[model samples]
Target chain A: MYRVKVYVTLKPSLLDAQGKVVKGAAVNLGYDEVENVRIGKFIELSINENTKDVNTAVEELCSKLLANTVIENYKYEIEKE
Target chain B: MYRVKVYVTLKPSLLDAQGKVVKGAAVNLGYDEVENVRIGKFIELSINENTKDVNTAVEELCSKLLANTVIENYKYEIEKE
Candidate 1:
């Protein structure tokens, strides 16, 4: 089996409202040193042995559905298990 | 400065409905070898220099807001920058 780890994060240019709230909460909680708090999605996909050309396949999958290219960026790593 | 990477995932006992949907979609797209897909959250907390006891601070943050211990498990690492 194989495990694919995908991390989807917002583009730097976009304003992260969720992150801003977290930062505010952090400061309220007395962690005044906290700065940027970026929230994103992490996805794990397990693939069995039958798949072929896994890299290209995953690339297509991510680009087609898992991530939005216009506002978010995604990076992935595959591990054999 | 420090960068903290946190990964929050559902407990093994919980049903990952979104993941299941993705797996079904993958199969429909001809990637029949795909098995399990687990969806989770990735958070980045950037901290500046004034904070003390960062490890404990992050743990507290994770427990209080970043993750729901009842159904989610979180692991984190800090990198000095």
Candidate 2:
């Protein structure tokens, strides 16, 4: 079995209202030293088959549907245990 | 130093149109075995200060802003290296 993890984040040039809210909360909670809180997405997928093409398949998955190239960027990693 | 990773995901009962799109791509790519591709978010933050209050601070951050309690759920793990 394999576990695939994907992270999705808004483009750096875009305004992340959600991250702004978190930054505010961090400051209020005394994490005044923390900066740049950008909120994004994470996905974990479990695959039963062990195929050599999994990585490419997943990369295609990200480019095609899991991420929006115009506004968001995605990075993924796969692990086997 | 401390690294905090946060994961956010839509509630299972909620509709995941993004996941649906990924599922379609998987099918097209011959991943006929792939199923139920729900997407979420992951955040990594670095803290230079080693304080006992960090976890509480992070929890407060999550409750206050890092996650939307209404439609999303969040889980975070902290690591020091």
Candidate 3:
């Protein structure tokens, strides 16, 4: 099997409200050193060994279902299992 | 500055309803090669270079705010930036 790990993150130009909130909370909790924060999604998919073209399949999956292309960017790494 | 990347994932023993839903959708969308699907969170934090004991601070942050110890596990990597 192939284990595919995908990370979907907001576009660099966009403001990350959730990250801002978390950073604010962290400072309030006394973590003054903490600075800029960004939040994203991590997805793991297990693909069968016999599957052909794992790269193409995963790319399609990410563009179609795993990420919102307009506002986010996604990247994936595949590892043998 | 130190760039910290944190990944928070549900415990292996827990039922991930969101993952199940996504897996089902993938199957429905004809990505039959796809198997197990799991979802998690990815957080990036920047810490001042002057911060002392980054490891300890990050550990405390993970346990206290970034992750729910009862049902989730978190791991992080730090890099100089």
Candidate 4:
């Protein structure tokens, strides 16, 4: 099996309200060092061994269903098991 | 600067509603090959250089602020920038 680890984050130009909320909470929780606490999405995919050309498969998946390319940016790592 | 990439995921015992929703959408979008789409949180922390022992710092931050240990499991990567 191949493990696909995907990290999806909003574009820098976009505002991250969720991250800001967490940052405020962190400050209340006494973690002053915390800054720019951006929250995004992480997805894990266990690609079937039969899938051909795993690289192409992941790229297609990311663009089509996994990520909304207009507002979010994504990059991934492929691991062999 | 230290780039700390943190991944927070729900434990196997927890229900992942967001993942289920995405999987259902994928099925409707004609991507039946997709299975077990687990969604989690991806956070990037730009650590200041003054922070000593980056490993310990990330561990503490992950437990205290980045993840909820009760239901989620977290891991991280630390890189120099």
* Candidate rank order under TM-score: 3, 1, 4, 2
Over 4 Å off in model 4, which ranges?
Answer: none
Candidate 2's docking class is acceptable
Q: Which residue pairs collide in model 1, if any?
A: none
For candidate 2, what is the lDDT?
0.77
Chain A TM-score relative to the true structure, per candidate: 0.95, 0.83, 0.97, 0.94
The candidate that achieves the highest DockQ relative to the unseen native structure: 3
Top TM-score hit: 3
Query: What is the C-alpha lDDT profile of model 2 across B18-39, one tens digit per residue?
Result: 8887777777877875666788
> A1-81 in candidate 2: lDDT tens per residue?
777888888898999898777677677877885665777778766665656688887787778767788999988898875
Clashing pairs in 3: none
Winner of 1 and 3 under TM-score: 3
Tens-digit lDDT track of model 3 for A1-81: 999999999999999999999999999999999988999999999999899899999999999999999999999999988
Where does model 2 exceed 4 Å of error? A11-17, A28-33, A48-52, A69-73, B10-18, B28-31, B46-52, B68-73, B79-81
RMSD of 3: 0.6
Q: What tens-digit string does per-residue lDDT give for candidate 4 at B1-81?
A: 788789899998998999888778766876566666789999987767777677887798789878889999998998887
For model 4, state the Cα shift of residue A63 in Å: 1.6
- The TM-score of candidate 3 is 0.98
Alpha-carbon TM-score of each model against the true structure:
0.95, 0.69, 0.98, 0.85
TM-score of 1: 0.95
Candidate 4 chain A weakest ten by summed lDDT: A27-36
